[model samples]
Target: MDGGQAMIALGIGLTSAVDGAAIAALVRRALAHAGLEASVLAVPDWRADLPAVAAAARLLGLPVAPVSRAAMQTVEAAVATRAPESLARYGVGSVAEAAALVAAGRGARLLVARLAEAGATCAVAEGEGP
Candidate 1:
Protein backbone atom coordinates (compact mmCIF):
# COMPACT_ATOMS: atom_id res chain seq x y z
CA MET A 1 0.00 0.00 0.00
CA ASP A 2 3.03 2.22 -0.24
CA GLY A 3 5.66 2.83 -2.92
CA GLY A 4 3.27 3.63 -5.75
CA GLN A 5 0.58 6.02 -6.86
CA ALA A 6 -1.77 4.41 -4.38
CA MET A 7 -2.93 7.05 -1.95
CA ILE A 8 -4.34 6.33 1.48
CA ALA A 9 -6.87 8.65 3.07
CA LEU A 10 -7.41 8.62 6.82
CA GLY A 11 -10.59 9.71 8.53
CA ILE A 12 -10.73 10.43 12.22
CA GLY A 13 -13.53 10.79 14.75
CA LEU A 14 -12.86 12.22 18.14
CA THR A 15 -14.58 12.97 21.39
CA SER A 16 -14.65 16.49 22.70
CA ALA A 17 -11.30 17.79 23.96
CA VAL A 18 -9.46 14.57 23.21
CA ASP A 19 -5.71 15.03 23.37
CA GLY A 20 -3.65 15.23 20.21
CA ALA A 21 -1.25 12.61 21.46
CA ALA A 22 -4.03 10.08 21.81
CA ILE A 23 -5.29 10.80 18.32
CA ALA A 24 -1.82 10.56 16.85
CA ALA A 25 -1.03 7.32 18.62
CA LEU A 26 -4.27 5.70 17.54
CA VAL A 27 -3.77 6.78 13.94
CA ARG A 28 -0.22 5.47 13.96
CA ARG A 29 -1.30 2.14 15.36
CA ALA A 30 -4.13 1.85 12.83
CA LEU A 31 -1.84 2.60 9.89
CA ALA A 32 0.80 0.15 11.09
CA HIS A 33 -1.80 -2.53 11.73
CA ALA A 34 -3.13 -2.14 8.22
CA GLY A 35 0.35 -1.93 6.74
CA LEU A 36 -0.64 1.17 4.80
CA GLU A 37 0.84 4.62 4.52
CA ALA A 38 -1.55 7.53 4.48
CA SER A 39 -1.38 10.28 1.88
CA VAL A 40 -3.80 12.50 3.80
CA LEU A 41 -5.69 12.75 7.04
CA ALA A 42 -9.33 13.78 7.19
CA VAL A 43 -11.93 14.69 9.74
CA PRO A 44 -15.48 15.92 9.87
CA ASP A 45 -15.85 19.65 9.27
CA TRP A 46 -17.27 20.32 12.69
CA ARG A 47 -15.64 23.38 14.25
CA ALA A 48 -14.85 21.82 17.60
CA ASP A 49 -13.18 18.77 16.10
CA LEU A 50 -10.68 20.55 13.87
CA PRO A 51 -8.02 21.39 16.43
CA ALA A 52 -7.27 17.85 17.50
CA VAL A 53 -7.47 16.56 13.94
CA ALA A 54 -5.14 19.30 12.78
CA ALA A 55 -2.71 18.47 15.55
CA ALA A 56 -2.71 14.82 14.57
CA ALA A 57 -2.05 15.72 10.94
CA ARG A 58 0.86 17.87 12.02
CA LEU A 59 2.21 15.10 14.20
CA LEU A 60 2.06 12.74 11.23
CA GLY A 61 3.38 15.35 8.79
CA LEU A 62 0.31 15.04 6.61
CA PRO A 63 -2.20 17.59 5.39
CA VAL A 64 -5.63 17.66 6.89
CA ALA A 65 -8.73 17.28 4.70
CA PRO A 66 -12.15 18.16 5.95
CA VAL A 67 -15.21 16.28 4.86
CA SER A 68 -18.58 17.91 5.27
CA ARG A 69 -21.39 16.24 7.13
CA ALA A 70 -23.44 16.05 3.98
CA ALA A 71 -20.69 14.34 2.03
CA MET A 72 -20.11 11.92 4.90
CA GLN A 73 -23.77 11.06 5.03
CA THR A 74 -23.65 10.05 1.39
CA VAL A 75 -21.10 7.37 2.16
CA GLU A 76 -22.66 6.08 5.37
CA ALA A 77 -24.45 3.31 3.54
CA ALA A 78 -21.13 1.95 2.40
CA VAL A 79 -19.46 1.93 5.81
CA ALA A 80 -19.06 -1.56 7.22
CA THR A 81 -19.03 -0.60 10.89
CA ARG A 82 -22.08 0.97 12.44
CA ALA A 83 -21.97 2.92 15.67
CA PRO A 84 -25.49 3.62 16.83
CA GLU A 85 -24.49 6.66 18.81
CA SER A 86 -22.75 8.20 15.84
CA LEU A 87 -25.66 7.39 13.57
CA ALA A 88 -28.05 9.11 15.96
CA ARG A 89 -25.90 12.21 16.41
CA TYR A 90 -24.12 12.60 13.06
CA GLY A 91 -26.56 10.89 10.73
CA VAL A 92 -23.83 8.43 9.84
CA GLY A 93 -23.15 4.95 11.05
CA SER A 94 -19.42 5.35 11.35
CA VAL A 95 -17.74 8.75 11.12
CA ALA A 96 -14.25 7.41 10.50
CA GLU A 97 -15.24 5.12 7.66
CA ALA A 98 -17.76 7.50 6.11
CA ALA A 99 -15.43 10.48 6.31
CA ALA A 100 -12.57 8.51 4.76
CA LEU A 101 -14.76 7.35 1.95
CA VAL A 102 -16.11 10.84 1.33
CA ALA A 103 -12.73 12.55 1.54
CA ALA A 104 -11.19 10.05 -0.85
CA GLY A 105 -14.09 10.76 -3.24
CA ARG A 106 -16.33 8.70 -5.52
CA GLY A 107 -14.40 5.54 -6.26
CA ALA A 108 -12.59 5.27 -2.93
CA ARG A 109 -12.83 2.07 -0.95
CA LEU A 110 -11.98 1.23 2.63
CA LEU A 111 -8.56 -0.30 3.15
CA VAL A 112 -9.06 -0.35 6.89
CA ALA A 113 -12.38 -0.14 8.63
CA ARG A 114 -13.00 1.89 11.77
CA LEU A 115 -10.70 1.18 14.69
CA ALA A 116 -11.12 2.89 18.02
CA GLU A 117 -8.77 3.75 20.83
CA ALA A 118 -8.88 6.28 23.64
CA GLY A 119 -12.07 8.00 22.58
CA ALA A 120 -10.95 8.39 18.98
CA THR A 121 -11.54 6.34 15.84
CA CYS A 122 -9.54 6.03 12.66
CA ALA A 123 -10.09 4.45 9.26
CA VAL A 124 -8.26 4.35 5.95
CA ALA A 125 -9.50 4.46 2.38
CA GLU A 126 -7.68 4.03 -0.90
CA GLY A 127 -8.55 5.93 -4.06
CA GLU A 128 -9.12 4.15 -7.33
CA GLY A 129 -6.15 5.65 -9.08
CA PRO A 130 -2.85 4.18 -10.19
Candidate 2:
Protein backbone atom coordinates (compact mmCIF):
# COMPACT_ATOMS: atom_id res chain seq x y z
CA MET A 1 0.00 0.00 0.00
CA ASP A 2 1.13 3.54 -0.61
CA GLY A 3 1.85 5.86 2.25
CA GLY A 4 -1.58 7.30 1.54
CA GLN A 5 -3.45 4.00 1.79
CA ALA A 6 -5.27 2.23 4.63
CA MET A 7 -4.51 -1.23 5.90
CA ILE A 8 -7.52 -3.12 7.23
CA ALA A 9 -7.77 -6.48 8.98
CA LEU A 10 -10.44 -8.54 10.71
CA GLY A 11 -11.09 -8.15 14.40
CA ILE A 12 -11.85 -11.40 16.18
CA GLY A 13 -14.35 -10.03 18.69
CA LEU A 14 -16.88 -7.35 19.50
CA THR A 15 -15.53 -4.22 21.17
CA SER A 16 -18.37 -4.07 23.69
CA ALA A 17 -17.91 -7.69 24.70
CA VAL A 18 -14.23 -8.33 23.92
CA ASP A 19 -12.63 -5.20 25.36
CA GLY A 20 -11.31 -2.61 22.92
CA ALA A 21 -8.05 -2.16 24.82
CA ALA A 22 -7.24 -5.87 24.73
CA ILE A 23 -8.19 -6.21 21.08
CA ALA A 24 -6.10 -3.18 20.27
CA ALA A 25 -3.12 -4.84 21.86
CA LEU A 26 -3.70 -8.00 19.85
CA VAL A 27 -4.14 -6.01 16.66
CA ARG A 28 -0.99 -4.06 17.41
CA ARG A 29 0.89 -7.28 17.90
CA ALA A 30 -0.45 -8.76 14.69
CA LEU A 31 0.45 -5.64 12.74
CA ALA A 32 3.90 -5.70 14.26
CA HIS A 33 4.26 -9.36 13.28
CA ALA A 34 3.35 -8.29 9.78
CA GLY A 35 6.12 -5.67 10.01
CA LEU A 36 3.50 -2.96 10.26
CA GLU A 37 2.93 -0.47 13.05
CA ALA A 38 -0.77 0.06 13.80
CA SER A 39 -3.42 0.29 16.52
CA VAL A 40 -7.05 -0.77 16.67
CA LEU A 41 -9.30 2.18 16.06
CA ALA A 42 -11.89 2.91 18.74
CA VAL A 43 -15.09 2.31 16.82
CA PRO A 44 -18.34 0.50 17.58
CA ASP A 45 -17.34 -2.49 15.45
CA TRP A 46 -14.59 -3.69 13.15
CA ARG A 47 -16.44 -2.03 10.33
CA ALA A 48 -16.29 1.36 11.97
CA ASP A 49 -12.60 1.06 12.83
CA LEU A 50 -11.69 -0.02 9.33
CA PRO A 51 -10.62 3.45 8.22
CA ALA A 52 -8.71 4.36 11.35
CA VAL A 53 -7.13 0.95 11.45
CA ALA A 54 -6.08 1.37 7.84
CA ALA A 55 -4.51 4.72 8.59
CA ALA A 56 -2.62 3.22 11.49
CA ALA A 57 -1.38 0.48 9.17
CA ARG A 58 -0.08 3.00 6.66
CA LEU A 59 1.62 4.95 9.43
CA LEU A 60 3.39 1.73 10.24
CA GLY A 61 3.93 0.97 6.51
CA LEU A 62 1.84 -1.83 5.01
CA PRO A 63 -0.59 -2.65 2.24
CA VAL A 64 -3.95 -1.12 3.05
CA ALA A 65 -7.22 -2.93 2.44
CA PRO A 66 -10.60 -1.51 1.41
CA VAL A 67 -11.81 -1.04 4.95
CA SER A 68 -8.65 0.76 5.99
CA ARG A 69 -8.67 3.25 3.12
CA ALA A 70 -10.01 6.32 4.86
CA ALA A 71 -7.89 6.12 7.97
CA MET A 72 -4.85 4.99 6.07
CA GLN A 73 -4.94 8.08 3.91
CA THR A 74 -5.02 10.32 6.93
CA VAL A 75 -2.08 8.70 8.65
CA GLU A 76 -0.12 8.35 5.45
CA ALA A 77 -0.36 12.07 4.95
CA ALA A 78 0.63 12.70 8.54
CA VAL A 79 3.65 10.45 8.37
CA ALA A 80 4.79 11.54 4.96
CA THR A 81 8.18 12.53 6.34
CA ARG A 82 8.94 8.96 7.34
CA ALA A 83 10.85 6.50 5.12
CA PRO A 84 9.92 2.95 4.05
CA GLU A 85 13.55 1.79 4.10
CA SER A 86 13.40 1.95 7.87
CA LEU A 87 12.37 -1.71 7.83
CA ALA A 88 15.43 -3.11 6.11
CA ARG A 89 15.72 -6.34 8.05
CA TYR A 90 12.33 -8.07 8.13
CA GLY A 91 11.33 -11.51 9.38
CA VAL A 92 9.56 -13.35 12.20
CA GLY A 93 10.07 -11.83 15.60
CA SER A 94 8.84 -11.80 19.21
CA VAL A 95 6.17 -9.44 20.48
CA ALA A 96 8.70 -7.53 22.52
CA GLU A 97 10.91 -6.90 19.51
CA ALA A 98 7.87 -6.21 17.40
CA ALA A 99 6.74 -3.60 19.91
CA ALA A 100 10.13 -1.96 19.66
CA LEU A 101 9.93 -2.05 15.89
CA VAL A 102 6.55 -0.33 15.94
CA ALA A 103 7.81 2.30 18.32
CA ALA A 104 10.70 2.94 15.94
CA GLY A 105 8.28 3.20 12.99
CA ARG A 106 9.67 0.12 11.27
CA GLY A 107 6.20 -1.16 10.39
CA ALA A 108 7.25 -2.95 7.24
CA ARG A 109 9.84 -4.94 9.13
CA LEU A 110 7.26 -5.82 11.76
CA LEU A 111 4.83 -6.96 9.05
CA VAL A 112 7.39 -9.37 7.65
CA ALA A 113 8.21 -10.56 11.13
CA ARG A 114 4.55 -11.23 11.90
CA LEU A 115 4.07 -13.10 8.65
CA ALA A 116 7.10 -15.26 9.39
CA GLU A 117 5.84 -15.93 12.88
CA ALA A 118 2.49 -16.89 11.37
CA GLY A 119 4.25 -19.66 9.37
CA ALA A 120 4.43 -17.99 5.98
CA THR A 121 7.35 -19.34 4.04
CA CYS A 122 9.83 -16.53 3.47
CA ALA A 123 13.26 -16.20 1.99
CA VAL A 124 15.51 -13.94 4.02
CA ALA A 125 17.67 -11.58 2.03
CA GLU A 126 21.39 -12.30 2.03
CA GLY A 127 23.42 -11.02 5.00
CA GLU A 128 20.24 -10.15 6.87
CA GLY A 129 19.52 -10.83 10.54
CA PRO A 130 17.44 -13.89 11.48
Candidate 3:
Protein backbone atom coordinates (compact mmCIF):
# COMPACT_ATOMS: atom_id res chain seq x y z
CA MET A 1 0.00 0.00 0.00
CA ASP A 2 1.05 3.57 -0.60
CA GLY A 3 2.39 5.45 2.40
CA GLY A 4 -0.61 7.74 2.32
CA GLN A 5 -2.99 4.82 2.01
CA ALA A 6 -1.41 2.60 4.64
CA MET A 7 -3.27 2.39 7.92
CA ILE A 8 -1.97 1.85 11.45
CA ALA A 9 -3.51 0.38 14.59
CA LEU A 10 -2.84 1.73 18.10
CA GLY A 11 -3.61 -0.31 21.20
CA ILE A 12 -3.51 1.10 24.73
CA GLY A 13 -3.80 -0.53 28.18
CA LEU A 14 -5.12 1.57 31.02
CA THR A 15 -6.32 1.21 34.60
CA SER A 16 -9.17 3.69 34.48
CA ALA A 17 -11.22 5.34 31.77
CA VAL A 18 -9.19 8.50 32.33
CA ASP A 19 -6.00 6.59 31.69
CA GLY A 20 -7.42 5.18 28.49
CA ALA A 21 -8.39 8.66 27.36
CA ALA A 22 -4.96 9.98 28.19
CA ILE A 23 -3.31 7.14 26.35
CA ALA A 24 -5.49 7.87 23.34
CA ALA A 25 -4.35 11.48 23.46
CA LEU A 26 -0.73 10.40 23.67
CA VAL A 27 -1.25 8.04 20.75
CA ARG A 28 -2.72 10.82 18.66
CA ARG A 29 0.31 12.94 19.45
CA ALA A 30 2.71 10.16 18.60
CA LEU A 31 0.92 9.51 15.31
CA ALA A 32 1.16 13.19 14.50
CA HIS A 33 4.86 13.07 15.21
CA ALA A 34 5.22 10.11 12.87
CA GLY A 35 3.10 11.84 10.22
CA LEU A 36 0.50 9.06 10.44
CA GLU A 37 -3.22 9.64 10.96
CA ALA A 38 -4.88 6.40 11.97
CA SER A 39 -7.51 5.65 14.60
CA VAL A 40 -7.13 4.00 18.02
CA LEU A 41 -8.88 0.99 19.61
CA ALA A 42 -8.86 -0.01 23.26
CA VAL A 43 -7.90 -3.54 24.36
CA PRO A 44 -8.17 -4.14 28.08
CA ASP A 45 -5.39 -6.71 27.96
CA TRP A 46 -3.34 -7.18 24.83
CA ARG A 47 -1.84 -10.54 25.72
CA ALA A 48 -5.09 -12.34 26.56
CA ASP A 49 -7.32 -10.50 24.15
CA LEU A 50 -6.13 -11.48 20.68
CA PRO A 51 -9.62 -12.27 19.41
CA ALA A 52 -10.95 -8.81 20.18
CA VAL A 53 -7.79 -7.26 18.86
CA ALA A 54 -8.17 -9.19 15.62
CA ALA A 55 -11.78 -8.07 15.42
CA ALA A 56 -10.74 -4.45 15.94
CA ALA A 57 -8.08 -4.80 13.28
CA ARG A 58 -10.61 -6.17 10.80
CA LEU A 59 -12.89 -3.27 11.59
CA LEU A 60 -9.95 -1.02 10.79
CA GLY A 61 -9.71 -2.59 7.34
CA LEU A 62 -6.88 -4.96 8.11
CA PRO A 63 -6.61 -8.67 7.48
CA VAL A 64 -7.24 -11.02 10.43
CA ALA A 65 -6.99 -14.71 11.31
CA PRO A 66 -9.91 -16.84 12.45
CA VAL A 67 -10.21 -17.20 16.26
CA SER A 68 -12.84 -19.17 18.11
CA ARG A 69 -14.85 -17.77 21.00
CA ALA A 70 -14.32 -20.93 23.00
CA ALA A 71 -10.58 -20.68 22.53
CA MET A 72 -10.58 -17.07 23.64
CA GLN A 73 -12.59 -18.00 26.71
CA THR A 74 -10.07 -20.63 27.61
CA VAL A 75 -7.32 -18.07 27.36
CA GLU A 76 -9.23 -15.77 29.65
CA ALA A 77 -9.69 -18.48 32.21
CA ALA A 78 -6.02 -19.36 32.24
CA VAL A 79 -4.82 -15.80 32.71
CA ALA A 80 -7.47 -15.00 35.29
CA THR A 81 -6.39 -18.01 37.27
CA ARG A 82 -2.74 -16.99 37.20
CA ALA A 83 -3.08 -13.25 37.70
CA PRO A 84 -6.01 -12.87 40.02
CA GLU A 85 -4.76 -9.65 41.59
CA SER A 86 -5.03 -6.91 38.92
CA LEU A 87 -3.15 -5.43 35.97
CA ALA A 88 -2.97 -1.97 37.46
CA ARG A 89 0.24 -2.95 39.21
CA TYR A 90 1.77 -4.06 35.91
CA GLY A 91 1.46 -0.64 34.22
CA VAL A 92 2.63 0.32 30.69
CA GLY A 93 5.15 -2.49 30.51
CA SER A 94 2.32 -5.01 30.37
CA VAL A 95 1.85 -4.09 26.72
CA ALA A 96 5.16 -5.59 25.64
CA GLU A 97 4.77 -8.48 28.06
CA ALA A 98 1.28 -9.23 26.78
CA ALA A 99 2.50 -9.25 23.18
CA ALA A 100 5.27 -11.60 24.17
CA LEU A 101 2.82 -13.88 25.93
CA VAL A 102 0.66 -14.00 22.82
CA ALA A 103 3.76 -14.68 20.76
CA ALA A 104 4.49 -17.58 23.03
CA GLY A 105 1.52 -20.02 23.45
CA ARG A 106 1.08 -20.35 27.16
CA GLY A 107 -2.46 -19.01 26.81
CA ALA A 108 -5.06 -17.45 24.52
CA ARG A 109 -5.85 -13.81 23.65
CA LEU A 110 -8.75 -12.81 25.87
CA LEU A 111 -6.34 -12.04 28.70
CA VAL A 112 -5.86 -8.52 27.46
CA ALA A 113 -9.59 -7.89 27.05
CA ARG A 114 -10.22 -9.13 30.58
CA LEU A 115 -7.51 -6.89 31.99
CA ALA A 116 -8.83 -3.82 30.23
CA GLU A 117 -12.44 -4.62 31.11
CA ALA A 118 -11.27 -5.02 34.70
CA GLY A 119 -9.89 -1.46 34.38
CA ALA A 120 -6.42 -2.13 33.04
CA THR A 121 -5.15 0.57 30.72
CA CYS A 122 -5.31 -0.96 27.25
CA ALA A 123 -6.25 0.32 23.79
CA VAL A 124 -5.12 -0.12 20.22
CA ALA A 125 -2.01 1.87 19.53
CA GLU A 126 -3.87 3.26 16.48
CA GLY A 127 -7.21 1.77 15.45
CA GLU A 128 -10.34 1.44 17.59
CA GLY A 129 -11.71 -1.86 18.97
CA PRO A 130 -14.99 -3.71 18.28
Best by TM-score: 1
Write down the lDDT of every candidate, Cα atoms only: 0.83, 0.30, 0.35
Residue-level lDDT tens digits of model 1 in 2-97: 454766788898887688789999889889988988888888888334667767878999888878899888887789897889999999988999
| Residue pairs whose backbone atoms clash in candidate 1 | none
Summarize candidate 2's per-residue lDDT along 3-119 as a digit string, tens digits. Answer: 453333222212223333344455556555556433322221223444444443444443322222233232232221232332232221222223223222323232222222221
TM-score, cand. 3 vs. native: 0.33
Point to the candidate with the largest lDDT.
Answer: 1
> Using alpha carbons, what is the TM-score of model 1?
0.89
Q: Over 4 Å off in model 1, which ranges?
A: 1-4, 47-49
TM-score of each: 0.89, 0.26, 0.33
How many residue pairs clash (N, CA or C atoms closer than 3 angstroms) in each of the candidate models, in the order given?
A: 0, 15, 38
- Candidate 3 stretches with Cα past 4 Å from truth are 1-4, 17-21, 45-130
Lowest-lDDT window of 10 residues in candidate 1? 1-10
Residue 50 lDDT in model 2? Answer: 48
Cα lDDT for residue 68, candidate 1? 88
